[model samples]
Target: MTIAVVWLEDDGLWCVSDTRISRRGQGGGVQIVTDAGAKIYPLNVECRLLTVERELYYGRRYGMVFAGMTAVATQTFATLSGMCQALQGASRQDIPSLRDVATLLSKLVELYVRDFRASTTLADPGVIEILLFGMCPVSRSYEIWRVSDQIVEGSLHVAIDQQPARTGDVVAIGSQVSRFQEILAELKQKTENTFRLPKIAVGQMADASRGDVGGAVSIGICNQFGFQTYWSLGLTPHGQGARLMFGVDLDDIGWVGPVVISGGGMA
Candidate 1:
């Protein structure tokens, strides 16, 4: 089984999940979605989960932190701790060094894969893939983390080269990425005014092969005053969901005060 989650906080965004990939009855966990439909019903996968109920830690932007655990507990904690350190050390800006964050995440994934191989776990386990997104200093970018369980074998995980377009980003996971994109495109084109994102949009982003759990996506605009008009799109094993929110960084708007936009357009 696998689990994933994305959270939006005042400071930034958070994404979390587990590495285990299991099928029905494999873990004795109930499927979150209904199985009624003439269309194909996506297979429900398992994941370690953390959310409002299983709170772990908290931050400024993110008031509550949750996750679903797997066998890779040590690896998960280490990776998260390392990410926090990197973020703390990173220079504060519009997009907080996304490449740097992605680099750190990749390193932690590799480290965990190596540790698992060295350990006497399940001999040879399959690899795991996770999709992560969060608010950065500039714009948001997605990171793909793949971990191979096969000992001394080829990579079980691979990062996608191109980032998906973020016209109206949503927080979601599942087998509905393509379908979700189609919906977003249609929404934007159909709107009479500028394609401004609603506060948040959530739904399932699935594909033909595998479904993602605890996945989330978000997008919108940040005006010159540092006010964020944002939306999130999320999808879990159960179904599609969305949330809308607006925020201003206390440090930017309160402490530093608003800045003037050079161009006439909103920042």
Candidate 2:
């Protein structure tokens, strides 16, 4: 089971992980270390892909990411690449908001699920969920939307924190949503006396987990009510294994700072 989390903040955004992934039917000690040696699927468009078959593309005014079980990673990536190609040449300033991105991903997942269900050998394809965070310049507001997954003949579940959503915020997407929330709750409940996970550290820890294919998480933190800092974590499964990729998108006035973090696991 792969798990990921992102955090958006005021000063800057950060992403991290534990670098552990487990193979199917593998027992104890048969673990895959993402840090040791693994192949990573990098986005030529400055985006991140997840093991669960979702994609996150970052733009100047818009940031978008999604997660959930679909077909194999290669097929999902091909579909996403097609979507990106369809999006190319459009003005960055006129990019879709996070909500719009999430909606599109949800729709795409539905289409894929339908196609898979029509196949004879595929059996059951898993579910897909998308969490979108958007910022509107004209309204000076942020919006977060959680799009539930609808697999043709399968089930996919998603859960989030109880707190009200915010624009330029983070989300956890996977079968292990409960675990993600537990981590978030533990972090929030910590007192000032104990060791506190910095926003970046928390973001990273959230990003690192097991079975995270096509999975992703994000965080958004504000700086004294100014611009926002965003961190996003993604998983991409490859032949016999998977890798975790991360990135940060900063919403500063003058300069735009973005970074990509990559690591993989063995078969």
Candidate 3:
């Protein structure tokens, strides 16, 4: 399991996630084996689709952060990425709404669960919960949605719930939710907590969770200026590449030239 946190600050939207991906061993034990996994996908120029003329076209400038079952999460991300590419090539007004995105994801999870149930005779399909965060271009705000699938009435039932972040609000998902709440409460009690960073709180929770949640913390910020990586593991190469190709440093503070939101009228 992993941890993902999303919040709205004065400047923009902040997202943080741990890179630890665990698995069950042959002896029926869980193992924390890697720290190189990415939990945040910056939906900017890096993920753009190329046209037949070999020209690059921009998609939505946002970040998608997730935490849940690895198999399902990865598959969902792949499907979403494909959909984003398709949307980019479609009509300019075809941009998907936040609810549309959530619904599509929920349907994907339901279909996966249905296929699993059909293949296995087991009564329980187990529990799967995926938390998704992204910026809604139509609403111009950061939204968090939870997609949960479980065995209900001996069949798969999926539900998608959405919450829009307000200024100073904190939202968290995955194994470290409770821990994040405790830290948030403590921070609220302090009189001088205005300058605290969300990444620091998430990093502290990951560190305290031992191996349950760990690895280098990855962060992304999205707002009117567009989405950009605040910090991430092994980001130097990516930063250099962006600078070379886009003429903007991905690591630079307040850098807005790296990504362009097409048809949304925000350049």
Candidate with maximal lDDT: 3
What does each candidate score in C-alpha RMSD? Answer: 14.1, 11.3, 8.0
- What candidate 3 gets wrong by more than 4 Å, as runs, is 25-29, 44-58, 88-91, 116-127, 232-267
Candidate 3 shows a clash count of 0
Tens-place lDDT per residue, model 2, 1-267, is 344343444333222222333343456433433332111122222233332433444333233334444243335545754674445323334444444454555566556655655664444344444443444333445554555544333553222212124423445555565766666567657655322243333444534533443223333332223223223334344322222223221222224346533222111
Error of 3 at 205 (Å): 2.4
In model 1, where do residues sit more than 4 Å from their true spots?
A: 1-23, 27-78, 86-96, 114-153, 156-174, 185-267
* lDDT, candidate 1, at 27: 64
Tens-digit lDDT string for candidate 1 (100-216): 444554566556656665674444344433343433334443322222233335444534232342442334333333544465566667776532322222222221213433233
Q: What is candidate 1's CA lDDT for residue 44?
A: 13
TM-score of each: 0.37, 0.48, 0.72
Q: Which stretches of candidate 2 lie over 4 Å from their true place?
A: 11-23, 26-66, 70-78, 81-95, 120-126, 137-140, 151-164, 167-170, 193-267
Residue pair clashes in candidate 3: none
